[model samples]
Target: MLRVMTPTAVLLLAALPALAQPAHLQPTRDVSVTYRMNAPAAGGAPAAPQEMRMAFSVSEGKQRIDPPGNMGWMLIDRKANTAVMVMDAQRATMAMPPATVGAMTQGVPPGATFTRKGTATVAGLACTEWDVTAGQGRGTSCITEDGVLLRAVTTPPNGTPMTVMEATQVTYAPVEATRLTVPQGYSPMAMPGGAGTTPAR
Candidate 1:
């Protein structure tokens, strides 16, 4: 039997941390990016690549993500160090602190070292490449000067290339303020373990 994924799981998987950054790489303006992911097949014929569109609107240390295909969106408030997941189809929103979201989206796992390899360009943006190794796993990422991740490839020890994610399109423009907030009429859902709550707009 095939198992179906929860909306939360889909959101987490789709919400790859493409924009996680250090101080120098912080985005200076709002932007939209279209990403394509190619996953290696375990056996038989190759699988088709998956596509996702993401939008980031930045303001005062806060960033919001509008994911593709109505899977809903997420809001990350750096100042508050919190993240809000909005599920429109369910009309429910879940709030999480930075630590929780960090665990879900962190690229380099603990006890890993990252090294800058060189630089390259993607979707008209110049980026620096980094090599990361953690335990038996290894990966590479191409990040822009402003800290946007343009491409990533990862492999497990003794395993074939796992996945490749790349940005294919990028545009810089102002994101409407409304896009960053929860849409009206959604209900706040209590987080598992009773973490906290954020009322819907």
Candidate 2:
């Protein structure tokens, strides 16, 4: 005799495909988030945790991070898979090496897998937590429905999980296009150990 499927079972079957894919790491629309960065010392030694405010914004598929202090800013283009640093004082831009691009792009490492956990509230907004496993190690990321990363944690091989960054505030608004793009007529800067300017655009 053939078995019949219940309505709930049918609905769950239809949702399986969507669940297989990981949550969106970048914001789908214009939004800004201020995060408190907690970085561990080299070699995982115990040290005072320094807190700094990083202003992040995403618009039209491009992301920008205004680092703490007057260290300038960084621009990332997901489509082009490139990250560049814009030094306003020097009026120069420097392309980030390919090795570091993965970390800069929404904290999700390349070739990583995600398993959606229960939901949580961060920065006064609802988000879904995802347990991520990658070649490097395992971690978790809480992401908003609109695709903003509210908080992220990481664990190295044979190490404990540590909070890398967590959003302290979130704002949904329109970001000016110019803020995400390189300023007009800004020259490229030569990176250390290399000669010649990297194109920024």
Candidate 3:
């Protein structure tokens, strides 16, 4: 079966702590969030919602995303404006282009507007709800004061809204620096075009 990155991969990567932003897009301190991701099964077959556990680690100006089932991880450097995907099964790394990295690191889509909705709690953490609008996409997000995203529902330009990510657990702890570095021996590989799927989300 074909595989896909976590449903909110782009958003999660773009939302990491940044040096400048009117609103905090990521946690201000070291932290980790485990999310329950729901998306359609690969191959476009109608099936039960696939649930996966993805852990996000953030500290200093770096962020790491550990995808489900230990497939591999992605490391993003906020200061350097770069991102690289580490595939353990293939023992290779795919680096994103600088243009793509720069756009995603902005936290929100260009010209995106946020309207305060209310407040809610998820995974024992309190967060404020915000209605987000950018281009033809619309969605809602629940974010904590320190900039942790607890829940997110996104509607693409002409698609149904889906709950891409929801927090199952949250922990505020220091993350080791080594976890954010690329593996020493992984060889570089050309990034595959459309390497992942969108599924039903």
Q: Could you give the C-alpha RMSD of every candidate to the true structure, in order shown?
A: 4.5, 13.5, 6.0
TM-score of 1: 0.72
Best by lDDT: 3
| Predicted structure 1: lDDT | 0.61
Q: What is the TM-score of each candidate against the true structure?
A: 0.72, 0.73, 0.77
In candidate 2, which residue pairs get closer than 3 Å at backbone N, Cα or C atoms, i.e. clash? none
The segments of candidate 2 whose C-alpha lies over 4 angstroms from its true place after superposition are: 1-23, 42-59, 102-111
Better of 2 and 3 by lDDT: 3
Off by over 4 Å in 1: 1-23, 40-46, 66-69, 104-111, 134-137, 191-196, 199-201
| lDDT against true structure, model 2 | 0.61
Instruction: Count steric clashes of candidate 3.
Output: 0
- Model 2: per-residue lDDT, tens digit, 4-101? 11112111111211222345545666777777666566787765643333333443556676654456677767667777777788787877767555
> How displaced is residue 172 in candidate 2, in Å?
0.6
Q: After superposition, how far is residue 110 of candidate 3 from its true place, in Å?
A: 4.2
lDDT of 1 by residue, 1-201 (tens): 211222332233323343233334445677777777675556635668767665665664556655444565766655555667777678878776456666444554567677778888888888888776667656777777665667777775665655566788988888777766778878777665675486533
What is the per-residue lDDT of model 3 for residues 135-167, given as tens digits with 9 covering 90 to 100? 765777788888777777777555767776778
